[model samples]
Target: MCHMTACSLLSYIAIAWLKMVPMQTIRSRVQFMKISTLSLIFCASVVSGNVSLKYLPVSFNQAIGATTPFFTAVFAYLMTQKREAWLTYVTLIPVVTGVVIASGGEPSFHLFGFIMCVAATAARALKSVLQGILLSSEGEKLNSMNLLLYMAPIAVVFLLPATLIMEENVVGITMALAREDTRIVWLLLFNSSLAYFVNLTNFLVTKHTSALTLQVLGNAKGAVAVVISILIFRNPVSVTGMLGYSLTVIGVILYSEAKKRSR
Candidate 1:
């Protein structure tokens, strides 16, 4: 694998290791089941979304995909009945708005592609809520690692069925990727690793920072993913879209710094 893919993969492994301790203490039935349940939903989305993007335009995909944190805050508000820091909601609005503005151009309305990205955001949002909730739970004696022990295998299981069933050219794609685009193989691996890191970071930062911080970072991840994709794949962009992205990044930074200062 190349440096980018390898670095991404290593980040995930290190993050996973960080979760080992907290997960070890997870003994309660409810916590275990909750962990399993969240892993399945979120990881399934990550896999499906990744697969969809292989067929879909990267710009369109990332644009829709960026709204994840909005869903996250909504889920957090609903599930826990917890009041979010006002700045969290403020950061979220521009994040979703920027994504919508960015997605306005082309890519013939393939509803299938759109649905997958929506599912991705939904899954991510709910998973964030679950992570926030789990972090709030203690006395189980484990660290965030405890959650990953159950989550990792569950995530693998979650991805397997959808991948086999949904991906039409799974066999062809696999072979072609193996021979022609060996890098696609590395990309898939790195992508999955990033998904896992997303989870681990959600747990870690949720503890040290506010749910707002995690949500903001999640939005940033989408931005970073989009920028990286544009750089690597040369995804098409317009003046308006680029302007929106710039504003979105600036807004997110301001929002984060404002919240951080408040804290």
Candidate 2:
């Protein structure tokens, strides 16, 4: 997480220096506070997602992640009172039902891991919705890049204490690992860079479209991840599990069409 945030800060700075994005500073203490609060949500989403992957098969984890759209819709309504078309709402039924069905068929389901994955998905959805609501005003609003520029550092600050308390001697462990395998350093760099791009694209997507739309699109990404992980890891999957995943993908398609029509 620290590496990712460091990469984010440096990349944003370079982008700003290159004149690709305006280097806009936070306008006031209130704006800083707003971004700080959102950073906490971002941290929670990233941390929980990473932690869940420790105990859950990647395929099963992605399967649970497909539920983000349902949580996004709920959070969007609660936070912004924004309503979507009736058809759009209807489409989310299969999106949610598929996860419950998949869970029943999962071969190695861990209760704690399942809860963490759900928390991660919900946190992601909540962060997106809150970003739209909290930063909607002209004065408060920031471009995606600029928002991340401010957010990345604040998130690192928020995570530092948690890291110290939760994990002992992380720095020493990382140093020892790096000494043993030089490839570890490169791998960390590659992973952190990829994470940086993922976050950048996420913010850009939310900026151009609605938050719910971003999460709807994320459903497809999750499905693709499920397939790739299954292929690479050869994770044992039941017929019911595949069917449930398929149902979720179908629901995402329907939701996309419903959104297009409404638009």
Best by lDDT: 2
What's the TM for model 1?
Answer: 0.71
Return the clash pairs for model 2, or none.
Answer: none
Per residue, candidate 1 scores C-alpha lDDT tens digits across 100-121 of: 6655644333667777778887
Q: How accurate is candidate 2 locally (lDDT)?
A: 0.82
Q: TM-score for every candidate vs. truth? A: 0.71, 0.92
lDDT (Cα, tens digit) per residue for candidate 2, span 131-220: 876667777778777777788888888888888889899888889999999898899888877777776677778777876577666766
lDDT of each: 0.66, 0.82
